[model samples]
Target: MSSIPIRIPTASIYEELASARTTPKTVTSIHEEDGSILDYTERSSDGPSMPPHGLSNQALPMDKLSRAQLIAEQYIKDNKLLKAHEELIRCVALSKIIHGDGHWRLAKAFADLAYSYLTVRGLPVQAKQHAESAKNILLRGVDMSKSVEEKREVLGTLVTIYYTLGMSHLLQNNGRESYVSLQKVQKLIADLEELQEKTSVLGKISDKDIALALGRSCVLQEKLSLAMNFFEQAVKMVISSEGDSSAVLIGIYREMARAEQMKGRHEQAIHYLLQAHSICQAVYKKLSEKAAHTGLLLAKAYAAAGRSEYNENTNKYFTESLSVYQIVLGADDPQTQNTRVEFSKWLIQIGKTQEAYKMLQEAVGSETEYSETVAEMLSIMGSIHLADGKIQKGYQLLKKCLEIQTAVYGSQHSKSKETQNLLTALQKSGASWE
Candidate 1:
């Protein structure tokens, strides 16, 4: 492949910027218009909390939003996305307001903020909107009034914004647009590479950017083999860019494992996931959310390995997934319980009905779990128990299940009627919900 030429930022430039950025950012305490600290939103384990990084809060007439953004940046450093979103939005809004609406600088802020949301919020739609805003602003032509450094900043923002747009398109199932944006990314990477080749000092930054673009592109293309290679490259670049000290290496390693899994290369996936798991465990103690998530991914890789390796180990991985999920989300969180319950079914299939029964009990009693989702949990439990000769116990659980169904959707709810019929049949067989 013909490597692109790109110039890396001068060491002096980074040193100066680092010094400037080191100054503790001033945060406006309040938004005059709403008394809501110029931040975007407040805490809600349920809804949007704060805007993440890359937002401009300068538009709010006050620095409150900037303050919020600062707060969000710290939270992001701590890996608290919800809190970061709250502050990042404030930061972007304030940046935009201060810089004037839709100004390139402000657009850059929006683009960065959107990037955080796409990765952390699990909300791609909103992320796409913000990235587009950035691209649109840069499209208006660079403001010549700005210095070279300023113009370069805008160009950099455009690169990231386009990357975000490409990923968002993939998530939205818009393959065509995704491909277009990816091509643009590739062109940008090539251009950056060329510049850095000529100016070797810029190599690190340019390589980091190129690796990110290539890794994402490969993953979206379903080229898992290539994706793994690019992701490894990205990890190396990330390490170099951040220096040997990194608090986030485990995450990238996990992502690398995911790419390998997509290729159905279980052995490699397990290797990377195990490395991720080890890093997460040592770096993070106390069953940290980060560790739990890494464990979850590792478990999935192990489970997918099926009997190709150790059957006992595979079961252990599923159990570990359930355990980690329970610690983070509690027993009732639908996603957590669902995982445990599903694993339980698989256990039953392997003649572990006794273990499955315990998981079922947890699923039934969990308030945090969605009770009305009988289509999977309840029905499956009912069938499993009945087949295993626990008819009476199954009938009772199934009755409670029906009552829950009827309570939310009325007795006429199709699922409810179906369960009711099952109960009726059970009665004829001399069985009881009690």
Candidate 2:
């Protein structure tokens, strides 16, 4: 996760926001070593780092029968998503014909297919459709399983698929929604605990993995204290047996940073981010990117804590982050384009308004999926307009931003609040921003 830098509202604007707090509002993924969503939406080098699963069925029935399945899996492995998707649908149909509905094999095939779309094509709706299809099969299998072990095993797969759907939402930047999907995990955990009354071992495994996944989701929601407890419990499980999980350690550090930052301990936040960064650097380059991204935000947090004191340090970190995004993601990557806009906003604040404008123009030109980014460009330009005493132009630019957000997310979104607050500020100051 990255830091969202917010400008402080003027007193009158703050008053307006306070008054409007009760007014209506509305509208709404990751990989880590050994799990998904430990940290999501960061710079990456174009291929999934998650490992492929090996099919366990050695039955001749599935071998000759799963010929198309084999070819589909290979296509995904080779990064051919469209072809893989086409083949997988065919496989799903054949599996239904041969194994009938809701078979374990059928569910696994659907899960495999959904993952390919979610991770590779970045299509959340398509991913969600297949995941639900897969979940239905898993559910049916759970209901039919006669043995305790069979039921427990199927439950685990169900938990992972639900978690993957949550990832799809996360990748689309809908954190609130991702939380909703994860509610399914809580139900799954409850089911397993009930099962544990009859079988202890399966119960322990289910409890641990669910807690770990839940804690990570809490981290995304900025529930730091809860996340801290979750990670601590998770640590108890790992250090006791798993040993030296740097990825897990990285999460612990991140949660600490968030906790410290929320508590206004900027220096401490920076320290935790640095420690996290160091851990990733030493672990492997794949992990270092997480650290690097946090390091950039660490500096931002520090700047926010003491805006007047560390202006130069803030600029340094911003420049470093820009360099990292450029090198790691290329300028055209959606994440990089967003970062470019973020960097430009900081530039505008430091009196480099023209430079900020130029970068934003370039960003708007780039190919990317995040339209919310356009808000940043317009917001910065509006601020620049206000600074130049061109109140109407600034107000209009910001207004345009609000319009786009409203059209896309509707009137009650968290996004529209930014616009509302800005308009209120303008109304008070006798500026034309409204």
Candidate 3:
């Protein structure tokens, strides 16, 4: 994540706003790693000529704010995210002291702090709170701006705030709200571009980011056409800016494949998956985990393409994926085991129950922990045994599946209940095992 610099142009409008309020609306506190709490409240009028609790040894508030901003930038560059987050908190407190609560500068500080929470700490809830606070302040301050520089600064801060807010909403699975927030960001960026008469706006938030986010939001809302359109726009933009061979295209192609599948355009979906698989083969090593994963996706896509004639392609990719996964990721890795389970299920679908059973036995032998994957494997194995009239073995496997499901998903979960019902039916049918 890039650091957004706080630039405050000299203006009497801001000066008047800064002096209109002495105290900020809320008190901010910082918790240190050593279990120390630093209160960043405003100093009383009659207090000594020193700073706040943790900043007593620092310079004046303005100078300290500048230093804190610089330190935060350095911390981010050094990948010290936790320390950078702390410094951003200090910047918020110092901005309140220097620019008051209602000034655009303070809003910019909040926007930066909000972005840090989202990008650096992956805390979307905190990001949304600070982004909303910034928006509130900016809404009140935007009308007072007169100069071009001030307008540019305000618009830049707004872009960051809306982008952060949109991503926060998306993370929380509020698709409609996320689309609304991202639309605001897109409009703000367009306005900024028009104001400058330039192709590039002055922020880290790009058109591609907006397009991809809008696409994801649309996908969540089941707006498949709009989602595909946005994804296509993003694809064109990325290809125009970065070359065709850029690694970013791999994910976009996979997303496009998913959208096509959702729309029941199986051939189109296969085309996109082929593109993604090709990219994976070229960008990563031939036998890399990424290549293996892409092969797995391609195999599943072929199997789901509603054409039994594509069984050859499906089997080829499945074997390639399994081989690479067993070599690169260990045979006991969750992903490898899951891939085995998926392939075994496909085998059973093609009427190769004995082959599927052997694969399931290998997976079960290596599984050391009780997980959803293990439970699924056991269930399938039990069903295979029951179909072969091995009642005693089937009963034992299903009983273990029931125990695992209850332990992992609780006894009241649908999976556990289903397994319980199956066991009951088996007993009621007079199937005896000793």
Best by TM-score: 3
- Give lDDT tens digits, candidate 1, residues 44-98: 3464334333334222334454556567667877977655655555456456545
lDDT of candidate 1? Answer: 0.63
Q: What is the C-alpha RMSD of each candidate to the true structure, in Å?
A: 11.6, 16.9, 6.3
User: Across residues 1-434, which tens digit of lDDT does each residue of candidate 3 receive?
Assistant: 43332222224433432442444332334545455554444443555334343354323568768878888888888989877877787778778878777999999999999988888878788799889989999887466347877777788888889999999999998989999999998888778877882244444567888899999888888899999999999999899989887778889889888988898888898899888889899999779999999999999998887578998999999999999999998888889989989899888988899999999898898545689999999999999999988888988899999999999999999999998998899888986554
Scored against the true structure, residue 249 in model 3 reaches a CA lDDT of 86
- Maximum-lDDT candidate: 3
> How does candidate 2 fare on TM-score?
0.53
Model 1, residue 307: displacement in angstroms? 1.4
Off by over 4 Å in 1: 1-123, 140-147, 170-179, 189-221, 239-247, 286-289, 320-336, 362-377, 389-393, 405-434
lDDT value for model 2: 0.62
Residue runs of model 2 more than 4 Å from their true location after superposition: 1-64, 69-87, 102-104, 137-153, 165-212, 219-222, 232-268, 279-292, 307-309, 323-434
Model 3 misplacement above 4 A:
1-29, 32-58, 197-203, 366-368, 432-434
**Model 3 alpha-carbon miss at residue 402, Å:** 1.7
TM-score for each candidate, following the candidate numbering: 0.62, 0.53, 0.85
